[model samples]
Target chain A: MAAGKRGNVYVVVGMAGAGKTSFLERVATYLERSGKPPYIINLDPAAMRLPYDANIDIRDTVDYKSVMSEYCLGPNGAILTSANLFATRFDKVVSICDLRAQDYEYFFIDTPGQIEIFTWSASGIMITDMLSAHFRTTILFILDTPQCQNPQIFMSNMLQAVSVLYRSRLAVILVFNKIDVASHAPLVKLLSDMSLFQSELEGVSDFSSTLTQSLHLILQEFYEHLKIVGVSAATGSGVEEVISVLEDVGAG
Target chain B: MNVFLSLRSTTNHGTVLSPRRAFAPTFSMPYAQLVVGPAGSGKSTYCHNVHQHCASLGRTLSVINLDPAADEFRYPVTADVRELISLEDVMEEEELGPNGALMFCMEYLEDNMDDWLAEQLEGYMEDDMVIFDCPGQLELYSHHSAFKSMTEKMTGWGWKMVCVYILDAQFISDGTKFIAGCLQAQSAMLHLALPHVNILSKVDMLQDKSVLEPYLCPDHQRLANELDERMDPKYRKLNHAIASVMEDFALISFAPLDISDEESLQFVLYQCDCAIGYGEDADVRTSRDVEYGDEPDMSNLSLE
Candidate 1:
């Protein structure tokens, strides 16, 4: 965010099965084809394999399974603990990224599969704060476009996004993934007008619909400041729009 | 003037002289269940099915709608909150959002318990059975004083109440989600401080019923082990802590409710009945013993 900084850090977070890693891989490939190769950091220790080779992989330093056995944690706990263990030595990682900042214009981070493990965990906060203090950082929250067609699921995702914004105090870009399966225009329309959401829930008598409608009204301010874009990881569509929006967000 | 007076007196006398049933339905002890849970957990469906089941058994139960935002009902509503105040009216008049409007509506209902709710409930006999369909918002039962005060006021009215907490079985497909649901139920229990019955609603939609068997009557050890296996080792203490707290309180077991099955609904109803000590105050008749003369002594009959 300063005049001297050359690289912008993007933290990709989303619910499991939301195609966060796939989106990151698409971004990496796009950046490479344009001759402006981005620095990719794989923070998810539990990832079996990645689509693109990460320059700095947490799995290289921390073995997720060994951490599980060593700490007597479950799979999720192991991932979180591995992230925590990796976060402690993050200063070294930051120094490396800083050294390469002169050459790299963009940095992409793939968080854990489970959204809360990265968004709600202390290690997540520490890593985010460290990166933001050193570079221009943004949270790329991926939403499953098809799954978000259900208003209940959509509201839950919005609440999660709002919580992340409040906690991190960082600029957020809501990336609706899986555009190949469904269009995000309806969701975009719902976000722009509160009355549409009310009418959408008009058929249901469940109090939850009312709750969701009320939540939409309460989230109007959050929606106003949010930067939204739709992309498909499988088809590599909407990449240009995402990159342009990222540039706009980075500049503003 | 005399003719007019005589005509009025004759009408009054005729009204007084008309044949009427002498016996008014006497109630035993009023029983009520406040159906509460998160959104889309099937609270209304539960109320509708339970009301129908009770009606088929020739039992009378009143269904009351307490959600001001509710637009429709499948069962015949005995008393509706929309009559007193609605979320729409509150939002339009007070210039409040939906959540704030809902809170205001509930608090308004709490304030009018003496005048409006009492009058609406005045027709019930002493032993009437009633089910209140409450809002699905978590805050109503968690920390809101409206529900707590309403409970206090209802108790003062000599009504035995049980909180029927519902959880969507489909949402709790994993070990961690199950633990989270238990914790939420326990939180509502601690907050309301009432006789609580947790129900796993919409069990008919579950893909495998056997997967939920262990959760119905949860084995503390097995639950903790499963929870530990699912969570990372760093949260091992937290997993164990939750399991132990659940076991100590003995309040986390859920009764499964399958609306399509009568037996399942009956079992769920039985649990709620047990929680409120329903049917414990009935007066048993011993008229047969009084009708028959005394027989031979029990000692002589045993010797033979």
Candidate 2:
């Protein structure tokens, strides 16, 4: 497939088990069938198994098992060590992507499952910087939908989303995942109707009622303009809507 | 002639070979102490509790009060940043209100890292542990560069710190809420990039542990299904992705800690200990000098 004139790169990021890989697989299938499959790169070092074929895999370059065996590390240590190693040799990863240059419509980087490796580590930042330098990357933030049903959890997730936006400096597309099993009405109601959470927001802190109120008001202002889509990767429901949004962003 | 030549060569030739020995393991204490969590998550309380716990154990630990708006603490502090940058002062001087002032205080602290934090931590021993009672602001751990910069500076000072993230157990009862808590915990973990331990604090406050039991030892697939069942149908796809990611990555399980329970506290502490490789240097000793007497006669064992 020839590269689309838009030439967009989307990075799907979330905590481990956030369904990033599954979504990528489905998206790849969808795009492949549509004759525009994305160039997918798997960056997780500690992944013992995966469901999809990665165009580029970090494991091939850095042997996580050898690092564990040679260094006497547990799983987390090995993952961190492998991430550090990738950071040291990220140029090779860039070259791998470059090899597939203009071969696909988009480059979808499947990040490390550990959120910390992508968000907090210097290596994560370096990867983002390198990707941004090469292509216009937008972050597809997959949020657990059930977690957002409650006001407090929603607030915390919002904080995390904001954090990632600031840290990665990528245009964020927030996707509430796992909606097939949960009551999306309450969350959709919460996001759609901001007035319902006024008292709840006020109740979080006494010192910042005015501050909180103003912040809430500001959030509502932005919320009205924001595009939030809920989807189920398992059933393929709402996947098209998500793709449309991605396409729009890519075009933009 | 060949025998004479071999004997002469053997007598004149010599080889020097050095045998290789196994390298000894090296251990060094952490240089930094990181207290992290959301606002009102009992970060300060945990710091104080840890201080008291260390004292009771006859261990020397110092507390650094990093919260500029902090009014009181249960532990004695060796150094405080309020003296350097007060939230009230930031608000009054810069005309910024509470949130802005808190950010200002953090930025101010960041600006003076060398003079303020370095000076405070200067006299401490290499192995000395300090508890940094941080502010309650969520952004400090989320996106701000101030905390990251501080961590870098601490690491530069030879501190091998672990970010102790405390979430209230009472709040994390349901699968959905637990997932949310895990994301926040994950955020802090990601933002800090240091060794991290996710603690479900205030376990003592829960009258019944049944609600939190599953979350303590979370099954990702089960939680994902529960989460899907609870969310609105419109977000089913989103819920699935969230569940799948969680199930796929195993990103968000927590070690529950009831500070009031010694065993719970000890378990959490043990996790932290392993994170920093704490007891790696201790000498191993075996006791084999005990002698036991055969006791077939009348029992002489005294009940004291």
Candidate 3:
């Protein structure tokens, strides 16, 4: 649906501390080093600082501080208002992307750290929808690996991932990030070895169990076909695998 | 002038005060369950847990998978949007690719709500608890009206609704991240404008409980100071504002849930029930019969 050569658009999504920016930086660096740097787009109007360069930054379209001053709102309120404004004038972003029609192979959107802006706001949806309408978009859902070490926490992460998958309605590649710190091997193995995890899976049905089996079962059922990959931004462990997944999804 | 005079005369005659008919009280809960959070924040997991929890207690609950691109699920789904409109189909049939297909799927789901969703929900009982495992798209919950419209439609059907917000507990270990988490949670609460429960999920993974000590019982000023210390001085004003809003709204403090601990899970459930006023309709009773005295005359002439 996207114009031009149907550029690959991967939106990296997660909470503020979920290493989205870091992951994007790594991916961009990797792509750049590999002679295929993406046209990076910064959709986070509230971001004070970022590690990567953006071809089309939301700040150029709407000044966050101006909105805050005009509306007498704080940063969060201003960001939401600005995002709403962006949704109304989404053509600007499209035009910017269109301007770079032939230069880039992929367009990477580094969204706002405010999850609500990216997940719940109409503007965020419009952005994703509009971009996808024109390009090949794959949602790269990042789960903080350190957070998933706990069974309950891991289940919660899966649910959130499912929610995003449904909301975005895009091909989602679930990435368990920060593996260097937390070592998500156990959780990844637990998920991969479905048969071995049957008892634990059954425990998800029993709310009274010490380990939550219901959470596991829900994740298992929701992402039965998806593969979970572990990566560490700090150590760059398993980053290549994630890139390969993206490449495969893009090719498909 | 003549019409105005006639209206005034009618108003003065008290004819407008007609006897009102006694209307029957409506007794139906709205069927809208809003599961919201960042991608990988555990909205679906919560629904599945709730379903399993209900089943354990001998209750029937159904989950509707609304993510078209969803490839996995740990809970049994009664309905799936993927069956109707998959991203792959959109890409292949329409030649739209992944993102375009995704948007198409969402629009298709929205358009077919009456036909597809209604048909799926038709078999459910009036009070059936249905949890919709929504997509990982954060826009839907934060600012999108799709879920809001969906909630409105579900409410029309007879279901009590609640928004279960899950935030990773590990992210809350630090003061700055805690503030960020709180701000995000508050934004969702305000944006959705629904009954919400903020959950600090994945407590079992916290290897060091001390890291979360300050956040567990948050002191806004202390947190602000800690944030000030960590962040650049230029953002001190912003930090103060955030801390103030957090304190004023009391928004981000979550009921910690360690699914690994059964007691923690139950406690979380109890809190959720209380939020929805789940069991407030039971009749109250008092025993009427009382024997003259079971322990009689302790101070009387018994010894004498």
Candidate 4:
């Protein structure tokens, strides 16, 4: 698309209500500040509202409501079906991105609310393959900062993040969202300090807590491979650090 | 839950459950609802709304928190699966993914239904309706046999079980999303093999409410026309194939829900009752209620 200047593709995925769309806008804001504005693609056909403008919107290509009624599918199934349908023509989407690849430094794509729907589905693979064909693709896995306080729940959510990391084998950037509401500093501390995690697990001898202890060990290695960023999409804080991390990735 | 194993619990259990002995035909039963949907589809909200609606109807419905992953609930839980086996415990004990751990939690519930759940359930009266606010994991209803087995167990315990599949109203305001919701409900119904009711939750959030009216009942013709309009001509076959299923299955109809509106909430309750024959046995209960009516007036005729 350009002489060594093609854009990077960012596939943003997360659990429902983890604020993926809002976070994408913040990333775009950070990218746009340096005049390398992102070319966005909104892959969630069922999303009711999006904060950012997308160069390619799935809603424009496939109407999820029509797919829902026509396919006699539920919201989950219709989203999947519409995704599959849109995925069939994803080569076209990639071609369009290639056409605009010169103007943008980043190609940001926001996935559906259901993380599994994007990460664990056939359509997810199709979309990823298309992006990786021309662009260096990375997954930004978002986690709700307020929701992951409990060691057990945190482990479960971490396992979820680890899933896409393992499945796609793409470089994953863990975005700890909603930091303005709940700071992730304690969580970052727990991940790094064993004694701190032990203290967090104090007074709990259940299987989950004990397993979370074991998982903390395994996650130590995983943490080595992945990158973590704490961002408040609401207040637009930490957006620069996220861009700096991506820039480092580009450099590496 | 271990609470059911206590001596105080066992003693009080008979007082509540014993009344069912006279009413159980061994087949007919008061209804218990199983709330299901994917994550963030408002299953919890629906459970909260239904609990309030039943409370207004002079019915004390027990809301059961079946999601081991759920941390908070709006209702006062009478029984909870989190007490028996939680995702936290499963994830700790078994090296499983979130979906796997959640599945383990549900299967664990199903395995203990006869003992743990039965004990907890027996403490409530036969007419104390139960609403199971299940996990958002779709596999539990799509293919997993745990819920199906639980349904069988509840049926054997003289409780009619129905699956309430909640879908976000915003998603279904359009055509493609409407089909997805139907297929999801159908998959759940097929797997659970229980009477199912589909709910379009959070209808008030939809910008143009009129867009959803067609999908509530889902007329085949209107849906196909809408599909044709929205989808590309090249994919007409795919669109028609999906629309045809809606016509044939007749299993995908949804009832719109506006949680804040009393009438709307009650309407959904009415649909659920019709699906499960809830209080259809009212004639029997009412007839029994009128027993002492003209008998004491025997001074006029019965004594002769």
Candidate 5:
């Protein structure tokens, strides 16, 4: 990110049940097809099964349940604590990635189910910082299309996207997932056309919606800078575009 | 439970209302379940299952969507948080990150709980059975004050609140994961300070029920032995320490929920009801049952 990084780091994040795992799996396949076997990392200690085989998994170095019993922490605390412990040893992970940096062009990191667990955690901050220092990092912020169909939910989703974009300080690729369930055309319109969003916001009136209208106006510039696309993780449609966006941003 | 109900026959005569019928029709005090769990743990699914379960039994349950990002919920949402604050508005308005924005949304909900929530509750009838399918965000229940303050408010309003903490059946199938689940449940229990029920949800999806058998009964020795074998020798003491806490204090035990099975759902709800003392305050309905002491003859009871 500072200058010319060797490779790209794509951090996939979203609300729970937004098809993050499936999307990552599809991305892995797309990468493999392009002859770029991306280095994969699973940062979520509590995840039971990973759709893709991660080259470096936090589970190997940290046991979530052991963290709980040893530290007398609950499941969530153990997750955050385990992630923190894993973060301490993350320099080694970065070194390992460094060794493989010449062999792979892309690195895909699958985060935990809850977006905040990783994004708001100390380990998450450290890992991302370490990776970005050596790589051109981008956040693949996934939004479940159906969840955003409601004008209210869509406004919230965009605001969430802007938050991630600003926080990561990395180029963001807004991904509207589950297109098979719902079309993302309306969501695209709401994000790009402030007037259209205003009309839709009129139907949902509350303190929140009024604030949402103001956000629609304020985020008009943010909309101009973001790269958004739709893909059905189930069908694997539009997964290739994610890679293209990364390449374009990574090149620029 | 039967004893408590059958004893109701002896307490107060004709005007005495049974717990099952206590709030019916008149719509006196409200009872609610604050459904919470880790991500993908079926908090929303449980609400849907309960809605269907109550429907078959000719009862109605109101579902309040407390998650701003919620969509495609199976149950009808009576009240939604989007009315109060959207996570998007907070994010755009404040230029905070998604996590920080969500925290703001929750804090906003907490700040206005007395008024906004009270107005939200005005639509629901008194004595209603309500379910709050909360966001899967662990922060809200683990250490946060939103749910705790909301619980306090409801209690202040003369409402009976029960905290239903759900863990995935697959999550608890392993000994190590079981300990984690127990500790997590205890955190919410301590934080909310309410009657709590830790449930092993999605039991129907577990392939090998035997893997979860040890936890189903909470076998301390087997879990510790497995934990000891699975973890490194350096953590051997820590494993024993955690397993011992789970077993000794017995702070948590799980009720298995095979949501697909109607009986399983009923059993889970019944456990929650008993925890809240749902029918303990019902009045005596009949003098005939006053003669019944240790046992009521099953054959002598009228069908009604």
Candidate 6:
């Protein structure tokens, strides 16, 4: 969209243990094989070990463990502080990418395990905003398919996704990860057919369901705007669809 | 002394003549319960059920919808925040997202409290037990100062408030989620600084109700042990620290709410009553006194 902006940036964000890194690794391997290896940026300070080699890693700049001990903060606080520390110097990161912009067509950012640490924190928003200003950015919200089979859990994830979308105001692609374990089709079907979700909620017959039932009506507009792609990082399945969807988003 | 009155019909707003007459002097201050939780935690439904339960017993109660994002209501709202401002309208006009629009709507409501919320609250009796069904956004109660300031203003207006923190029973099925829920509830408690009651809402959805026993009155040590077994060894210190925090305060026990069972609902409401000292000043009554006139003695009153 802008002159001199050379690559499309995909920010991978999701709840803890949502297989963000696994999916990223899978996608990176695929891209590497396809002769278009994407530049990877690992932003998760608390990440124990990344499966893919990152071109730029926050952990290289900020020691999360030391930040925790020095500040007398817990794990979450340490991660937030570390992210904040990285966000302050994010301009350098943008410049570094800008220098190498001609070498790569795509940039993938791996966020922290704690979704809120990246999504809710001021530093996280600043970093996201900075990236969007520099590149064609899209959020890849990885959802744990098995965990979301439950209607209540599904609604919770939907709410969080909506919050993240509105907060960032970025184009988001709901990448339903771990479809190898649980198919995302049923969940997608539930979205399309209101009665199916209602009937599933009928078994519960509680007040929460009633509220969720009402929320379904409100979230319809949100769902209509969303682009969903089911992928199994374990099996390297359905990633092409994600790439295609990202391409479409980038083109538009 | 507490002066209990009959609930006016939802359609009988015009029939209420001097609603606050019997409540103002005797009670000196009214009472309120703020029902709040994350999205889909059954706040409005709790308010609806509690309202129905109280009305059945001929008690006067008012339910207020404080969520601007709320689009439906099962209970008749005495005062709705949507009336003054709505999330949809704010999002459309201000070009704000749902969360931002909600925050904007809340602040907008706060700015116009005297002209809006205060006036809407005036129609109800002073001592009528009011339930404010708040928005589902966790930030609003956990750390947001908007709700805190609003509640303080209401307190200044002579309304004793209790915070009803609801979590779905699904949370109890997992140890970590339950801990997260507890921490969220505690954060709200510290922020709101009100008499707090934690409700495990939608317990009826659980196939085995006994699964909730341990969670109801949590044993911090056992919780730690279970959490230790479930979580990775690396998180042991964190788990222990969390458990100790909960144990130190010991203010986070949950009341499992089964709305279908009248006894369960009463128990939950009774806890709220205790928190607010609802009937502490009420006149002593004999067994023969019928709380609701002409109502059948369906309840087996065991005279002490």
> Among the candidates, what TM-score does chain A have in each?
0.95, 0.86, 0.87, 0.93, 0.94, 0.95
- RMSD (Cα, Å) for all candidates, in order, is 19.7, 24.0, 22.7, 17.7, 19.0, 21.0
Model 5, span B184-302: residue lDDT tens: 56546645768888888888887876666567666777777886775435445545555555565566578778877666676677778777765443324333211212232322211
Q: Assign candidate 6 its CAPRI class.
A: incorrect
Give lDDT tens digits, candidate 4, residues A111-189: 8776657764668867886776677788888888887776544555665565455446467888899999999988887
Q: Scoring only chain A, what TM-score does candidate 5 earn?
A: 0.94
Model 3, A1-252: lDDT tens per residue? 333536678888875557888888887888899998888888888676778888878888899879977977534456777878878887777777776757887788887775656765557778887877877888888878876654534544555565565456566788878888888778777765655555544543223332233334434544555756778887787878987887787776
- Interface root mean square deviation per prediction: 16.5, 15.6, 17.5, 16.3, 18.2, 18.3
Residue-level lDDT of model 1, residues A90-156, one tens digit each, is 9998889999988998889998776656754568878988998888889999999998886645655
Candidate 3 lDDT, B223-249, residue by residue in tens = 879877765464465456556655655
For each candidate, the DockQ is: 0.03, 0.03, 0.03, 0.03, 0.03, 0.03
Question: Which regions in candidate 5 have their CA more than 4 angstroms from the true location?
Answer: A1-98, A101-252, B1-28, B123-126, B281-304
In candidate 6 chain B, where is summed lDDT lowest over 10 consecutive residues? Answer: B295-304
lDDT of 2 by residue, B81-165 (tens): 9889887677679975345567778888999886777667655543467778887555567556688889876665456788888
Ranked by TM-score, the better of candidates 2 and 5 is 5
lDDT of 5 by residue, A1-252 (tens): 356567777888887668888888888888898888889999888777788889999999998868877987545556778888988998998888888888988888888767767654556768887988887788888888987776655655555565454345566788899999999887777777867887776765333444444455435655666788899989988878877887887775
Q: Rank the candidates by TM-score, best first.
A: 6, 4, 5, 1, 2, 3
Give iRMSD, candidate 1: 16.5
Clashing pairs in 5: A74-B184, A156-B88, B12-B284, B27-B126
Better of 3 and 4 by TM-score: 4
For candidate 1, the docking band is incorrect
Instruction: Please list the C-alpha lDDT of all candidates, in the order they appear.
Output: 0.75, 0.65, 0.64, 0.71, 0.71, 0.75
State the TM-score for model 3: 0.49
